[model samples]
Target: MLAGKRILLIIGGGIAAYKSLDLIRRLRERGAAVTPVLTRAGAEFVTPLSVSALAGEKVFTDLFDLTDEAEMGHIQLSRSADLVVVAPATADLMAKMAHGHANDLASTLLMATDTQVLIAPAMNVRMWEHPATRRNLAQLLADGIRVVGPNAGDMACGEYGPGRLSEPLEIVAAIETALGQGSLTGKRILVTSGPTHEPIDPVRYIANRSSGAQGTAIAHALAALGAHVIFVTGPADVPPPQGVQVVRIETAQQMLQAVEAALPADAAVFAAAVADWRVASSSGSKIKKDAGRLPVLEFAENPDILATVSQRKADRPGLVVGFAAETDDVIANATAKRARKGCDWIVANDVSPATGIMGGTENAVHLITAHGREDWPRMSKQDVAARLATRIAQALG
Candidate 1:
């Protein structure tokens, strides 16, 4: 999709800088040429030789290299590529870019470049959430720079939250979205993913076994088709996709609120495995386990987000797709679910332990719709996403 594209990749200083090597391979696989510029601190983690080897081009490092300057001026270097991408765009690098500082070759090229810029930020959780970093991010976005990921998870510092760099494929998807011809352009879609956590106390909760790989793939596929996506996700094993607005939530109720806030979408896909019940009167503190006494737990039904959105009286989406994770009578169960929930379509899959579909990489799904059911062959989750996204585009049209 990115054939003939020339990408100038700027590797910033962060532990996530190592992923930049893999990003080069992904970009080159899609027929884009990568020209890498490594920062001083970035060189600390990865050697220039490795970057050059993977990118298949000489790595540029210094602003005052007389020989390199004679070969290609900074102005020429900055504007030479079709796109400028900064992977592991550290806080310092972003601050410099936001303020147009050019102390180093990376910042200098970023400032002097006339081409479009995309950054994938990586820092500690605290740094990423800091006011200074927030200001820099806002400024960068306001200046028309595209961003990919700083996914929330366990960090290298034993801290957890949003600050990790996106995976290689996610970054590549972002690059494709930035450069590819729009297929679902101007369309807005809402997608929910992962397993919601229903808190029972300060230290415990209820969740599911959803790996979130399928939903993440779907979001990426839709984004690749040029649709503006609102991704409302819960605590998932896999990180969310790139190039979409991600709203993280913990409970089903919060997911409903976030989904409602992203209103009037063209379609809504409920891929998340939300808990059906929550603690009615969860203890404020952890419930102590007694040797002989048993504790009573009361449960209440959680919000049915798919049903609520599908049965909306006003401003309902043109297409509302829901998933049925059934172990037996998949088609019958999903068909019944479609009619009962008032959704336009239902994606049914057998998640039995024998099939290993719950947390596996592949899926065998039956798409149930008003017209009838279509049984798709077993395929990778990514393939399933692509086919479903294409069908959605056709349906919306």
Candidate 2:
């Protein structure tokens, strides 16, 4: 997708810096010409020699190299690339860019360049949530810079809660989305993701294996196509796309409320794996276990979010899409789901243990519409997302 693209890769200092080498190789494999610019601290984590070797290009380190300056002016060097990418963008670098500080080659090139800047932030959980970092991130977004990852996982700091850089493949997907032509421009999209946690008590909840990858990717894909996205997600492993308005929820009831509030959208994709049942009367306090007997729990059906939206009298989206995760008769179930939900389309995938679709990277789905079922070959969730986004754009148009 990035064939012939000129990519300026700026590696930042962080434990995630090693991942940048793989990023460089992947970019090159995709026909992207990479120019590595290593920050001093970044060099501490990953050697310049490895970066150069993987990128198949010379690494630029010094901010003021007389020889480099004579060959290619700083201004020219900064503007030479079609896109500027900062992988493992540390807190320090983000702050510098936010404040327009140019003490180093990376920051200087950032300030001097007119090309689009895309960053994949990597930091400790605390640093990521700090108010100052939040402010800096907000400012960067306002400045129209693109950001990816900072996914939630066990951090190098031995703590958890968001701050991990996206995987190399995920970063590549983000870059592709950023560079792709805007196909959904002027469209408004609503997407729901993740597995709703049905609370049984303050500390206990029932959830699913949904990581929200497919839905999140769809939201990013739609946003990349120029759609203003409203992403309603439950607890997810990945951060919401940078440019979208994310409405976070916990329980299925909460998700329904959030989705309803985000009505009047051009299209709505109900990709969330909302729990079918929730505790009928959740205990206010934790239920103590008794050695003699097991605790009894009552359950109630959760709201049918897709059906409600699809059958809305007013402000119903032009197109409503639902998802069916089935172990058998995937197409039939999906077709029936589309009819039952009154949604315009349904994406059905087999999540049987044998298929390994749930919580996995690739997905094989059937797109069931009013017209007919279109079976798609197994592909990465990113590919499905891109194609779905394009299809939504065309349908809206």
TM-score winner? 2
Indicate the residue-level lDDT of 284 in model 1.
99
**Candidate 2 clashes between residue pairs 3 or more apart in a chain or in different chains:** none
TM-score of 2: 0.61
Taken over the whole model, the C-alpha lDDT of each candidate is 0.90, 0.90
Cα deviation at 149, candidate 1, in Å, is: 22
Give the lDDT of residue 249 in candidate 2.
96
Task: Give per-candidate clash totals.
Answer: 0, 0
lDDT of residue 324 for candidate 2: 96
Considering summed lDDT, which 10 consecutive residues are worst modelled in model 1? 173-182
User: Using Cα atoms with residue i matched to residue i, what is each candidate's TM-score against the true structure?
Assistant: 0.57, 0.61
- What are the RMSDs of all candidates, in order? 9.4, 7.7
